[model samples]
Target: MSYFLSKLVRFNRSSVVGAVGIVSVGSTLLFSDDDTRFRTFVTARLPLPSQDASLLTLAVPNDLFPPHLPSFGQHGILSLSSYRVGPGSSSDISKEASGAVHDGSKPCGCFGRDTIANAAAKVGPAVVNISIPQDFYGVTTGRSIGSGTIIDKDGTILTCAHVVVDFHGSRSSSKGKIEVTLQDGRTFEGKVVNADMHSDIAVVKINSETPLPDAKLGNSSRLRPGDWVIAMGCPLSLQNTVTAGIVSCVDRKSSDLGFSGLPREYLQTDCAINVGNSGGPLVNMDGEIVGVNIMKVLSADGLGFSVPINSVCKIIEHFKKSGRVIRPWLGLRMLDLNEMIIAQLKKKDASFPNVSKGILVPMVTPGSPGDRAGFCPGDVVIQFDGKPVESMKEI
Candidate 1:
């Protein structure tokens, strides 16, 4: 008979139901005679709750082995014991709070319901509902609803560029009018000071008779995955809706997600962001804005994405100086090549090189710099100015 120890114990007990019994010396224990194995797994190591900790023992029948493991007719019991060390310092607590030890459950204390409620109460007043009226041939057609965050006491709002721009990707002038509704039920006309399509950010200003509540901006560079966060927005035309979630990832570049034109990193979250949530503020646990909710994957759940607040700040500063964003123009249409693209190209043309990555030029303007430099369709750009171009955004 052979004994096998596993930290994650899973088994198919269809052959033996009444022959097995699981006993726990301490901690919560659950038993089942069904064919399905336990859904949750126990970790090998657990931290000490205090200076003095006791031992915990768990026993399981040897017959409850998974199908992949070797089947041995063992009559002995499998005992698992866990011992806790001394008390951890404050730094260890901080690490745990930052989700260093993710146990698929929310940590206690700092992430309690009261903490989230307080954060929402503190930042709720600064969130505003934005409505843009769409018109065609001097007649009102429809309205676009979104959310915004007040960034200044004088009612300067920050939101997504698409909220203020029309369907044609241009700033809506005669066809639309910007309106901002505050949390206190006050509505005011807002004017688009500037909008940048590259970053999908826009700045709108409302000349309010009284000072408005401005939300505090936090440093997004300090954000980490699993950090507690709240998303405040008007989703599905609901006003002042707040949803809670954790930071799923940081430093996600646009090129990594098949969006090369953005040319910047994004903050990925699992917050319940839906339609009309765009341009809303993604606040941290401290009630400070860390990101702006942009869009989410339509086909997947819990795959929401946000624009980093730091990048939005830079664009806001640039808009303040110049009326519009100034981007270096290289008149060329290109596509970044990946493994799948290279495989498809090789199938069509056998002479195509088995390259790993490159930027494939699809078109070049007639009188553009690319045309002047003798660039043409089907040209693969592998390098630019002595540097390797792995993606179109890099070029």
Candidate 2:
């Protein structure tokens, strides 16, 4: 029972389930997001009677595996092999979210119905699967698949920094190779041009024989909650797979997600993003790319996050001219002051700052730039560069 439960599916609360079943250990489990199921090929290293089975291959109902693993997870699966468990399989969200099919992407009509096929028609070809080096008992291989978006005629692809650089926190650059496969079934050698750890965005180049199709960049600044969007990626090694969702929050703060950096804007969506969907494009109704699918919340349903394409635009533009991103850094741990935080701080110390609007500097690095400038811990920064500041972006 334990062995069979190891293949358990991590289901999202929001995803709809059409059927449920169990597969024994050494047997097979089927998966699908629609009625028309495709043959899925799953390869795993299992300890079965055949002790020499380095990789166990299986044929399932749908040609996709649910990322039910611990990594790259939340309510949705990571789309990798036991890596980031993909969310549990369920029926289409569009049909459920919207009561009717969309004649066009009108806000009052249908929310997510027919727009998926339309966005897929425009941006699907640009979605590519990224295969990076993986180590199985010191034997290097390229089996871990992540997704990417082709954005330039010169074959420039946009992906997450975690996908191509220092993967899985290994921090090793001497990996075997990077392979990019498009929806057309054409594969090419890919090279990492630049990667920014701060933004978790990376750029890659593919030597294509001809000008390739690319996704159109859209204005992410206009994104609002409840706006329909489509997430396109190769989750579970399923190439060109698409998921439908709506924007849950336009400006999800980085700190709220337990990230240890200055706050940044992220688009929260209910898209069924899986492990292989990392670095794919989140497209709007007009078939314009709005964001890049980055990650999902763990142990929660309908909580996926994406880096706004507007940020990607800036990072890519910087990469073009300087071959890297230039970021202004301050060595201080700070938080945006709010009414609740201020009230809590005062409870700890009656002498806490009475002011409500500003950034609370809790800790400052010993010898960093901020220290050299006479900054100290427990200080409230009300201004930066002659402007009153409340958030890190102001500084």
Candidate 3:
């Protein structure tokens, strides 16, 4: 009787373990559903009515990977490989703050809706990715990235002058060859028809069968602080990437490219401007381009600037006419008039004022306007053409 009782206890333990395994398996199957069934359930329960269901469905791609599908954490599953599409697989789809589709067909009737999507969709086709053939340490290779539009059709492309011009090589000659890649992935050899390093603007031409979508030029001179602005470019080679920020300030003068001498008018925006985004368009509402993204302050956050398009137009005109640009020169050597310099100048000339003000002329061009205007080595220029000459920058 004791042997029989011990055997019965062991049999009961085995049965309990087998029952637990079956129950766990059943629970998993019941909770998880396949792509098709899940979609049906979601569609049925979706907050939208049957009539508006089409719009919600349109937001989702037809092919989306089902939930619970295993994904490796590193190096995302590449696009075409086992990237099963059934429920959520639209690479182009992203959320807009106002829930408005960037479709022109839809009425963006409300004012508060984020117009970024609409703006991006409007200008995206015009922005082209630029690639240049580079020879790094004697190895010929190709480097590709982003730049964008001022003109839509007739193959006229606007980008940062530095993008096409190779500054490393002979500064007198064309820097590097440029290739413009459109949104459709077609590439063409782009020639630097015009460029101005001073203003940092360049125009390239391509022959396309279809009429290109040209960007509508807006008046950057009219741009004010707190105005709505958008920057669209390939940040890190990611094409048609749209970032939204306001015009942090306009007409910000910083000696970013001091080598170019003096500063030009700049539109300061908080938009994330990356290296590849150079030569891309900074647009405003109504889909008009106000500025061209140029450089960003490295040490500070949210500090990015663009060359005003108005300043670029004259340069572009010069490129169209001359095939090169001739930058205007004031032709004078200037130094900041500070206290140390003021004391030294006062010691030399007792007639000079004690207050540190105005730009001190160290040397003036003999044949240039400065010399003609009686400006000498010791002369303190309080004003230049009626503009206050404060520092070397102002001078």
lDDT at residue 231 of model 3 (Cα atoms):
83
Model 3 per-residue lDDT tens digits across residues 370-395: 55655455445565555565755554
Query: lDDT, candidate 1, residue 9?
Result: 18
Estimate the overall C-alpha local distance difference test score of candidate 2: 0.63
TM-score of 3: 0.63
Residue pairs in collision within model 1 = none
Question: Highest lDDT: which candidate?
Answer: 2
Candidate 3 local Cα displacement, residue 229, angstroms:
2.1
Ten-residue stretch with the least lDDT total in model 2: 16-25
TM-score of 2: 0.62
Q: Which model scores highest in TM-score?
A: 1
TM-score rank order: 1, 3, 2
lDDT score for residue 285 of model 2: 74
Model 3 has how many clashing residue pairs? 11
